[model samples]
Target: MTTPLPVFAEPWPEGVTHRYLTHVGATVDVTGGGDRTGYRCTGCIYGSSGQYWHENVAHERAQAHAEKCLALPRPTQ
Candidate 1:
């Protein structure tokens, strides 16, 4: 069986604006533009509850989460 790739090893999806590397080596993908932006963590249940109206706001939240997140990537089947 092929081993699962780490979250950080995965390619960023379309429209991704930034990728924040978490403490445990996972990634938090930030997407959207203009008045709609959000982030989703690859290793944890942490993410923006909804899109932010400002890009900086989303980035700030994503960066904060990345700095403190310690969850490791889950194994994929």
Candidate 2:
């Protein structure tokens, strides 16, 4: 068995969340800090750019894209 990713344990604006889904794969932790207060994902669209949004839009974007990716047809072996 594999260990799960660390989830946000604090309140909003200081929260971080992550998970690995089929077709969507794994994602780096989405977090923020001083002057960089926002969210980011390495396996998402921004992809390591560390693009931070003012709100939790980062999670929405990543989730939306992942859902679409998961819905895609899987290639046969």
Least lDDT summed over 10 consecutive residues: which range in candidate 2? 68-77
What lDDT tens digits, residue by residue, belong to model 1 across residues 1-77? 95554455456778788999876678788989767988889798888767465788888888988889989965565
Cα RMSD to the true fold for all candidates: 5.5, 9.5
Q: What is the C-alpha lDDT profile of model 2 across 1-69, one tens digit per residue?
A: 976644536443335545324344434345553344444343444333655664356555555555555
lDDT, residue 34, model 2? 38
Q: TM-score of every model? A: 0.76, 0.38
User: Could you tally the backbone clashes for each prediction?
Assistant: 0, 0
Pairs with backbone N, CA or C atoms under 3 Å apart (clashes), candidate 2: none
In candidate 1, which residue ranges exceed 4 Å CA deviation?
Answer: 1-10
Candidate 2's displacement at residue 64, Å, is 0.8
